[model samples]
Target: MSLPENFNGWEHLQKTYMLEYNRRVDKFFSDVQGNGDLSNVRSSLKLACRLVDGDNEATWSLRTSLFFDVIGYSRKNLSIFYGSNIDTALPVAGHPQLFLYFSQDSQAVPLNGKRLDHEKSCRLTRYACKSGQSLPAVTKANLLDIAHEIKAQFVSGGKGIIYTAGKLSVSYTDPANGFPKGTRWLVNSKSEAIELYGKLCNVIDRPFDINKMNVNTPEKDSTTQVINTTDTILGKQYKQYAYRPVANLRFRYAYVSFGGSASPIFLIDTTFRNTALIA
Candidate 1:
């Protein structure tokens, strides 16, 4: 297989460049691609190159760059493609303004441990209802219960609910172990939840009954009333909140494969067959 003129075999990425570039690319993929890692893309690129001629220095380099290019494409478009236009991987609260700062040296930053790119700056908009006045009168127990129920809803993986209430903030602890840490739920508050419920009620033109929530105990009297409203407004709202447009916390991390033999970085393939020939 002939290599493109610009192609250079697997340009050895400095440990730092390899780490930071892969971290951002992986995050973009996870957010947009539904999978946090890209084993398939990486493996496919390598396999495609191997199928051509892995032993050839030029082939190896071209395929390696192609791998990174696919990842780079995702990274460059991270801001463009997301679950929502208004959404961001950074916590919406606090910093209001966020910038990912990386070292200019490129080789300075290390791959391991908490890197600077992981550092986030945000100013949480404190706890307040839509009125921007006071937080709802949701009882702590009720709030905790709601959080627990939401966390429990995802049986495949556990998540933590971050609740900001006035000066004091709390998170849903593991019911089984009583600790407050999990893979997701970095930005959540009781106030936002109450506001969401209120918005839901307004949108559906129905009354929201906390007691009717799955987190609430089924009261026969309330159940009958809610059931009467269920098929219409109440049910729609429930489904909307429980299933559709549910907010999630996105965390960025470097993508790693089990082999650990290949560099995590990816690039665009520059083989003659893949690219247009220069005049």
Candidate 2:
């Protein structure tokens, strides 16, 4: 049967959401086509993605409010899936947002467009998976090679390849990995991740250790070089006068498969107020 007119890809994210949400998603997807991270869009497209995003509230919201009038699929006989920790072969989290599968038995995997893209990323990363326990550096082109190895897994593998765009004049051989080819690396945070494409171009033909280039992987594990806020992302010095000391700060890190990873660094984990100290 055909999907409802209103209930469609990015058309209807949640069942009970406001009518204006459709407009928001439409604008979001269209604008997201440009660059940066489109993680939120992935959650809206498929149930698997949504589950990985941990949007359980939305599930109840759909059942009660998103009646068939909008999305017939939501009320279909088919069971909706949101992976769990038991799923091993499947990455811990759905690609892009780092979601884990939850089911005990293997059912038909969702082969949607975004899933295909994520699978492509996983394939290349797996193929390049070497003897080293540590993560390796990679480029966009070489990632394609890895993707080619497991093309069938990706629904759109044969149709097209993933692309990354930026204004920093950034480019990478295996741009898929965001790192350049033959470069040893590790991805530790988002800031360094942002530099991957540009760095790849700089190291165009140089042969380097893949492990050395890992974004989040620390050098030799003992590398406790604290990231200073004033200088880099982790530096506590970053919160000078812009944000009040009591205000929570946003902390961000980059994951290899997922575009941008973030967390909220509260100013104080505990709170103590002594009125006596004041005046």
List, residue by residue over 67-177, the lDDT tens digit for candidate 2.
332534234323333334363443322222211111111111222211111111111233233333344534445433433322222113122122221111211234343
Query: In model 1, where do residues sit more than 4 Å from their true spots?
Result: 1-61, 71-77, 81-131, 136-152, 155-279
* TM-score, cand. 2: 0.18
Alpha-carbon RMSD, each predicted model: 20.0, 22.1
Deviation from truth (RMSD, Å), model 2: 22.1
Tens digit of per-residue lDDT, candidate 1, span 1-279? 987888655543434444564554343233133322334543333344221322356654664466556434423412222123464343322111211111111122233211112212211122221233444322334323432332232112321122221211223222112111321111234454354344323322345454432222122221110122223474564311111111222222111111112221111111111111110
Worst 10 residues of 2 by lDDT: 269-278
Instruction: Please give the clash total of every predicted structure, in order.
Output: 18, 37
Q: In candidate 2, which residue ranges exceed 4 Å CA deviation?
A: 1-19, 31-279
- Tell me how many residue pairs clash in candidate 1: 18
Instruction: Report lDDT per candidate.
Output: 0.28, 0.28
